[model samples]
Structures are given as structure tokens and as C-alpha cells.
Target: MKKIIFSFVTSVLLLLPNMVKADEGMWFLMFIKRLNERNMQKMGLQLTAEEIYSINNNSLKNAIVQFNGGCTASIVSPDGLVFTNHHCGYGAIAGLSTPEHNYLKDGYWAKTRAEELSPKSLYVRFFVRMDNVTDRMLSVVNPQMTEKEREAALNREMEKIQKENSEGGKYVVSVRPFFQGNEYYYFVYQDFKDVRFVGTPPENVGKFGGDTDNWEWPRHTGDFSVFRVYTDPNGNPAEYSPNNIPLKAKKFLNVSLKGVQEKDFAMILGYPGRTNRWVPSYWVDQQVKYAYPAWVEASKTAMDAMKRHMDKDKGVRLKYASRYASTANYWKNRQGMINALTAHKTADQKRDAEKKFAKWASKDANKAEFGNVLSDMENYFAKTNQESANHNYLSIFFRASRITPLVVGFTKQLEQYLSSSSDQEKEQIKNRLEKNLYAYYDESYYPAEVDLFADNLKLYAEKSSSIPSELSQVKQQYNGDFKRYANDVFSRSIFTSKINFDQFMKQPSAEVLHNDPLAKIATALLTKYYQKTPEEEKLADTYAKAFRKYVKGMRDSKISTTLYPDANSTLRLTYGTVKALPADKRNADVKENYYTTFKTMLDKYKPGDPEFDMPARFVDLYNKKEFGRYLDKDGTMHVNFLTNNDITGGNSGSPVMNGNGELIGLAFDGNIEAMAGDVIFDKKLQRTIVVDIRYMLWVIDVYSGAKHIVDELNIIQ
Candidate 1:
């Protein structure tokens, strides 16, 4: 989350301690077995025995779908009816909805296929092929080359690869190194540019319990949205077209009516954003103590401020929902991680891992290199900690308000003075500003951000003693009065000062930007101290070299493992058994299950509490025994499934496939107990929770009467 190299290494290294000698010795064997297991049993996967015969075999086809778009989805119908998580399409869905048609609150449904709303920009990709070109790519660069030289060489190599493989097309192709640097794969994708909205349930249905219910099991959230991918007259990817044809996928998943039963193998395939399973204990401790708590507190402060502001202004609430939700997500996740670490033996396990790494390094033939690497890493961690804190503080401040735009404009003016630019470049700068201007109008754009910044400032002030001396001086200037500082910094008007930022927008941007409090702070920080800080320059160079080295090292040491570093944007595959394990040492006996009944939902409800109250539709469904076609093997209706398949943020829309490779469910969230899976993947604690596809179809058929959509599914039942 912090984007530190130490955290990245720690994520992988931490797992090493728990692994036995047999696990290490049989890594290659187990890797092959696991690959075969995934291909045979996982979602949209296919592999032959010959493909798994050896690691060197290139017969296995690429199993993942690629997309220029950010999220993943599955084609449930031959007509190209795509299903993904609601949050995955929230931006587009929200973009198309307004006060007169609040799709988020009331849901959206097209009477006919033609009535589907075409989004401004939406697309999906399918991976056509992948070639192992690592050796060829790296052959252009010397192994002993400097980081800068390697980078320059890599750029040229990539340019050549892209030109040759692109085939004069707009398709996105990326050459990714695997196994540290021991292998390479060239991924070629076919992009479908035309995608449109079909349907989405209301937030009450899709998001259901909101922040409280997120990442928790017995989840009632439907979490489904429907979209259609359209193609041009030539049946190729294209922009929005009134007469576009439906794009048919070469490998689309068939939605299975036979849902997951107990211990049935389930696998998820998509771009799992990130996991920091290899982080050091020091980093983990820092996160548990400082980073997470700061995030939670800041989010709480901002949410409270937004609620107060929104209570008197509906327009403001609508505008800020996205911003509020973003903060709330981080806050909720941080809290979950805190709870998870407390519940589990994460800290103890991390310590054990450090010891194991040290032992292994002693016996390793590359002991000197490994020892130096570890020491360098530790030294880097210690040097960067304070600077990292400072960076976080500044990032939070900049992101919190419109001061960023003003600063950007100021920087552009400075750049223009410093360098001569062509007419095309000048136009690009103008276009970029205009684009950002539209983004500035969003409700959460100003008020929620300002509040978050103000809150973070308070936290920073409290933690000032721990910060670098230079940054501490800046924090001291703020003292402890966040509200006072916020008023001075962000207030464009009295109403805006109170968090009703929509009211403040009545004043022009110039009026606000000229007198805004943060401008002065920005000016002072940017001009006088921050821009010239030795620590800043040193850290920047360090990170630059580190990144280049990381890329080169990955290219050089090609170690093959099923586990891949999350790119935050790319499709991924995760495979594991469904095991109900304890949350932590404190709850050693409690094993998580796939489903929680209506009985469990009712037990948690308090009649008079607004947060706990079930909506009438949900109550009616429960009371009427109207689960439709969603009964599991035991004849009980299921709401969610808790699996051991490792997943995280970008995995929102991933399909949970059965061993037979049938679509059993859609993965949307994980249990709160497994929130730390991003940093330290505890198979014992982490669980990828999915919305049972059976329940989804049941709701569509019985509840919404959208059986036309259901008719498209290839249901076994």
C-alpha cells in the first residue's frame, strides 16, 4: 500500500518461515502440480497433461483476459452480457445516473437490449497469446550494465517488441518478466472499445450493508452489475456505436446452476491488485501502529464532516458519495487489518520468518550477496521511514483539496518559463487542465478532501515528534487546531467552511484559489524548503535506482512461482482449497463458512437501529421462502462463500469457478478477518467471499422478474 520495496520483499519473504524443508525442496514439483490443478479445476482455465509435463513447455495457452479498462468481468451469455461487481462499474454507472434517475439508489434495468445505455468510455480485453520473449528482450542489455543503461536498453527493446507484435493495431501488448528475472512472457490483448451498461441493483441491494457489511461474511450484498460489449461493423473493437454488434468472446464462462457445495474446489481468476506477503516485521509493526490507525482516524473525521455537511444539502451528499466512499473504504480496511492482526498470529509469524531467512541465507551459496541485500534493505528502511511519513503527510494534504489544481497551474507556469515547448505540448497542457476541471466538480472533490487533509494534519501534528526535523518544523506551524487551520486553509465561504462545499462552488475558482489557506502553505513548503530538501532529493534518487534495479533483477533472476507480484492493474489467477480456518489465535476454534443463513442476519439486527435494520424487500424475501433457485446441496439458500483463494482490491469482479470450471459465484469481497491478506497472506485467516451466482440468478428471476437476462445463462439446473 505504501509502495516500499521492503514491504514488497517482506510479503514474499514472510511466507518462507512457515514453509518446511520439503516445501522448499519440492517447490518445482509442487509448482507444476498446482499449475495443473488450477488449469483443470479453476475458472476459464484449460491445460493438457503435456502442457504441465515440464516448466519449459510452451503448449499451455494464456488463461487470463486482458483489458485496457481497470477491472475484470465474465461473459455469462453468448450475446456478450457481462457480469461484474457493482463497485467495479460504479464510476461509469454513477456517471450515467443523476438526481432524476438515481441508479445507485433505485437500480437500472433496460426494457430491451437496444435500450442499454452506452457509457462514455468502457472496454474489455481478451488475451490472444503470450510468448516467452524474456531472453530475447534482455539480450539487448548487458547483465553488468548500470541501472540507467539497463533502463535505456529496455526502452528500446520494448519499442521494438511493441512495433513487431502490435501488427499496426491499437491492441495493448506488455512484456512482463517472471520468476524474478529468470523468465519473460509477452502478453498480447485484443481490446473491445465499445462497452455499455445493462443493469445494476440499488446500493441497498448491491452494496447492501454499506461499509459495515463490506469485507465481512454472511454478506447480503448482491454486488452484481451487467454490461454489454459491442464491436464495430468489422466485428473488431470500436468506440460507442449505435449499430455496433455484440462481441463474442472465444473463451466465455458458462454460468452453472449447480452452485458450490461444502469443500468443493473454487478458484478465482482476474487481476488481483496487490498483496504484500513479503514485508518485514518492522514494516508490519509500523502499519499496525501508525499507518492503519492514521488512515482510520482520518477517514472517520472526514466521514463525520461529510455527514454533517450533507445533512443540510442533498446535492452535496450526491456529489461527495464517491469521495466519502473512498475514504470509508480505506478506513474500514485499515480497521479490519488492525482487528485481523490482533486476532491472528501475524506478528509472531513475521518474526519466525525473519529468523528463517537469516538461517537460509547462511547456508545459501550466495550468502554474501543475500546478507548485503538484507542489510541494505534494513538500512534503506531505517533511512526512509521518516521521509516516508513526510511524503504521506504531503500526499494527504495535496489530495485533500483544490490546492492541488492551483499548485499544478503554478508548476505549469514555472515549467513554461523554464523550458520552451512546442504548440502541440502547449495544447496538451490546456487539455489536461480542462479535463481536471471536470473532475473538480465532484462533491467529494473539495469538502471531503479538505476535511481529510485537516484531519491528517492533526494526526501529523500529534506524530510530529517522530517525523524528520525539517518536516516537524512545518507541522509545528499548524499547532493542534485542525478546524482553525482548515478554515484558514480551505474556506472560500462560510458555508464551505462548514463542509457544504457545493455552496462554496458558487464562488469562482479564481476567487477561492486566490485566498485559499493551503496556497500559502503550498507556496512556503514548495518554494522555501520542500523543493530543496536534501533528504527529498536523496530519497527520490534512491527510489529511482531501486526501481530500475528491481526491474533488472526481476529480469535477471527469473524464479518461477505460482505467486506473482500484483501489478494493481493486470489479470491474475489464484488457486487454493476451501478451508474454514480460525480468524486468529484468539479465535482458534471458529472456522469461517461459505454461507450464513437468514437466521444469522436476523440475530444481528436491532429493530430500532437504522444501521442494523433490514429493508422491507429483504425481509419479504426471507419470510416468503422466496429464494427461488438458490438452494445448495443441503437445500439451504446461500448468500456468500468464504474461500481460501488469495485476492485483493482489483479482484472485485473475479469469477469464482468450480473444480469443473463452471461459474459458481462472483468474488466481490473478503472477510474482515482476512484484511491483512494484502500485506501478510495468512491462508488460515484470509478468505475470498463470493456472491453465490445461484442467489444472483434467483434474485433476477424471482425478485426483479428479469428472467430475460436469466434466459441467457447456460444453467446446468
Candidate 2:
């Protein structure tokens, strides 16, 4: 009973709200009624827990989907019309964009099914069910076993259990640990591969305010996108094929045209990627003081290099647009997190919790289960800090370089070719290299690549624990002039041009690769990495043992508190009210900005601006007051809104639903003031920014001129 209660506190899987407030949790639906139903009902939930998560019948869970592994999406029509965020679908949009048919610059719409563009590698997954496998998993090990022994035993059962219950490879089975391995749950999923892009507003409409407005409230960005899921005629998950038809949605959410108001109930259901509200104070200190600064600096440098190339050419921009946005968003995310965590004194707060736990463990009755946990964790972090810093700092060079990926791939293939005895194996590998591999690097610009190479090499030399010994010699030979060194490496590299790549393909050999300048650099760097980290590995083993004990202690001490595991990209539901920041810190007056209007969007609008520009069609509709059925009584078209729902990265396109299970908005961004939300929940400051469902409908109906798509939705007025 004590263990179960503790599992409820730290795991994101637990529905019980034992934190700041009921609104602070990204809860699992399975335990809703048992822990949260009364409070939820009192707060204005019209649907029962069964109506939200039942497996025997259609429920709210049937409508929500994991969008392409990153964002969330909702089925809005019986024919499987899906709604998600524009940025969530940014990659798919960018892939479909070309200079002649720039769907990114000018919006895209498919009046007919044939016009819907299907990108090569985008898929959505549906959760079939979840099962508590805690007892079955925990039965395999006991306190006497070492972490290695326990893992080996658990692995044996994991394979058998997954194999036994996967429905003959039809369902994707995942068994994830929760509450720091105190509990486990099995989730079954079905992946649909035929999702197609239905419509997207132009850059100005979809990405209004762009970076400036991201993570800000009073936001005006119309950050929504449309999609359609296709499955076999029998309505089964299938690969992309011409024979597939639109999926018959088991359940679909109705779009609410009424919008939101102050104190209105709002809930979100989606896959929230991760959260670490239970991490130790030392870990938070590591990120805030040591690690994140390097990441922010290196990422900003990489983004600058990519943006330089993207700005030079339209085709390059099309290829790198999504990459750049992803880079920029996270770079700023790290910067903001550093600032927010410092302001909140998150580490100090975590230390207080640790102190409480330490006192609890100091009790003689509890000492055996939690002895040395705090000290062990402290030493583990201290020991691993240098290794982590070196790896993260040096890893950016490979991440930022186009040539490194190709070289890595080629080097692997060359090594394999040398060892393989079969003629057919070599031939097969060569064919793939000729056909698929070389074409991927077409978007890379030589000048940017050269510059990035020099910059990263310089950065590594200055920051990494030790530069690769070979590269150290090369640095001396070049008199520490990395620019000239970069030119020498790029100029000699066979991957720099198609002419050289073609030559290398003809006589690919391990000897040639062993002598290659880039390959030598890769080898020396990887060698240094392996040589640098024997101590951290041992400390990590110690940390893992101590972590389990600490969690056990936390559970024992928090017997009265509800505990939940941290998030691990599983489906969750979080509920809260339409809320706002205090208008000013000076008074009791709170500014509950429930929604934004098109008229307000125009206030921040600038003609021909990359971030704020709008298509003339949208401008014309706004000018003429053409909001159709999607406007409020005040005659303003809604664009975006705010809710206090808890969400993180993977919940981007989650449905912001009303009391009656109708879609009101799409969850997109989180407020910057609570950027450290992944580490700690700031109940008062945290807010999920959502694009108003009415605004999405109006854009589909008016701006994009896709009324047919609007007609598909079950619009609730």
C-alpha cells in the first residue's frame, strides 16, 4: 500500500493530484475516477471517467492520436479528418514544398482527395489499451539482487511477455517503467502509415508572430494544421497504398464554436514526451550551471550557420526550414529554462525535498532501504559531469556537419565490406549506397559546411576535456589555424563532390577509409570518447543502485501522498481552467485572456514580414469581417487562447476540449515564465497555449477556401 501510494506521486502515469493543485498533473486516464473524478466533476467535467477511457466501448481516447511520434492529433470527423498544430506538421509541409509549388510559402488545400499530399515518412499511432504489469514484473526480482542481476532477469521476462501478448505482431507493445522503476505498465498501440496532409495556411497565417510569439500568452499565431488518416478498406492499419481508404473513426471530437471564457473548464489529452519533476537538486544544478549553457551556445552557433545557407536560396530554405525551426525553438528553450530555473530557485527547492527524505531515511527502521542514496547520487553526478560535458560539446560538431554523417555511414559500409565473405552481401550494400545514400546530402552547401567545420573544431579544442590526439597534432601542424585546417580536410575529402564520391564508390576499401582525413578525425574523436569515461560508467552503476533505494525511501516517507512516475511519451490527460497571468505584479487583478481575435492578430501584423506576414486572402477576409459561423458575439474571429493544462513537448497538437468532450483548441506552446516545467510544476505560472478551434475552422472555411473540409467536422455551436 505504501509502495502504491508512492508510485502515485512521481509517475506521470498516476491520475491522483498530490502536488501544487489538481491542475498541476499530466495524469493517466485509467485512475481518473478513483483519484480525480470528484474534483474534476466539481470543477465542471460533464463526462465520466468511463466516457474518457473505456476500452470496451468508444471513448475520448479513441479520438486522440500520437501524431508522427512527436505531436498529438485528434480525429474530428467519422471519416478520420485529423487536427494538429502547423509547427507539428512543419516537416511534412516543408517536404511537400518546392520552388514551383511552394505549399509552405503559399498555403495548401485539397478540395478533393487526389490533391492531398502524402509525404514519404509520416505516421500516426493509436493507443489500443494499457495494462498494469507491475506485479508480474516485480515478481522477477527482490532487494537482495544487484541492478545487473535484476535487469538480466527482467529482460528475460520482458521478451517473453511482449512476445506472448503482441497479438502476432499486429499491435506494438511497450512496457515502460514508472515511479523510478517502482511500477510498470504495458501499452498497446497500432500505427497508421497513410496519413496525408489536407491543408495548411501560408507561413504568415500558420506561424504568425513565429519565434517572438512562441511560448507567450496573448499569442495570435493560428498554429493549426489538417490531416486525414488512411487505412485499408477494412479499416485496419496499413502501409501507404492507393487501395487504402479514409479510416472510419471509432470516436471523433466535435469542434466547439462557443470558444472559452474566464473560469471555463479546459482539459487536454495527448502524448506528453517527458517530464522530470522528481529529479534531484544536483541534476537541476548541473543543467542550470554547467550543461545547458554549452548546449545553448553550440546550438545557437549551429542555427546561425544553417540560417545563413537557408537565407541564400529558396530550395535550400525549403529543405532546412523545419530543421532551423526545431533548432531555434530548443536553443531558446534552453536559454529560457536556465533563466526560469534560476529565478524559481528550483535546485534549492529540490534540496529541501531531499533534506526531508534524508531525515526520513535517517530513521533506523528506514535506513536499510535508503542508506547512502543521497550521497551516492551526489557523487555520481559529480563524477559524470566532465564526461557529459565533453560528449555534449563534441557531439554538436557531428550534428552540425553534413559531411560527418556521410563519412560515418561510408566508413561503416567499408568496414563491413572488408569483413564480409559473401559476394552477394557486398553487391547489395553497394547498390543501396549508389541508389539511396548519396542523394540525401544534396541540400548541403559547401561554404556553410566548411565554416561550421572550422567553428566546431575550434569550439571542441577550447571546450572539450581533451581534443583528439591526431587532431591535436594536426592543430600544431596548421599552427592552430582551424580555418586553413578545415579547408585542407574538406578539399581532400572524397565526399565533397559527386565526382569524388563516384570515384570512391568504384574502389571503396578499408585502407582508403583508414587514410581519409575525415575518417581519421572521426576515429580519433570516438577513441578519445571511449578512453575518457571508465570512471563515470562505474559511478553510473552506483547511481542506478542508489536511485532505486532513494525512490524506495521517497515512497516509504510519502505514504500519505499520491505519487506518479515521470513522463515517458505515453498518453495522458491534464485538466485545468482558462487562465491568465496577473495583468501586473502590482495588484490582485488577474488578466484571464481566454482567447485572441483576428483583429488582435492584425495589431501585430506587418505586411511582407516573414513571421507576421499574411496572405492577401486572409487580409481581405479580416477587412470584410468574414468570420462566418466561427466568430463570437463580439464579432471578432478567435485565433488562440490560454489554459492552465499541464503539457510538454509531445503534447503539441493535443485537443483542448470542453466539459462535454468537444474540441475547443489545439495545445501548441507553453508559457516561458514556467519554462522549467519539465523539472518542476509552477502551478501559478504554467499555461498551455492553444489555437482556438473556432479559428482553425474559420481558416479552413474562409482563408484557405476549403469549406468542404469544414463541413466534415461535427461543429458544435
lDDT of 1 by residue, 291-311 (tens): 566566655766776777666
Q: Assess candidate 1 and give its TM-score to the true structure.
A: 0.78
Q: In model 2, what is the error at residue 599, expressed in angstroms?
A: 2.1
Note the Cα lDDT for every prediction shown: 0.61, 0.81
Q: Estimate each model's TM-score.
A: 0.78, 0.94
Candidate 1's clash total is 24
Give stretches of model 2 more than 4 Å off. Answer: 1-20, 142-149, 402-406, 419-423, 527-532, 559-562, 585-592
The ten-residue window of minimal lDDT in model 1 covers 21-30
Tens-place lDDT per residue, model 2, 264-301, is: 99989999999987678889988887788878877788
Please state every model's RMSD to the true fold in angstroms. Answer: 7.1, 3.0
User: Looking at model 2, which ten-residue stretch has the lowest summed lDDT?
Assistant: 583-592
Best by TM-score: 2
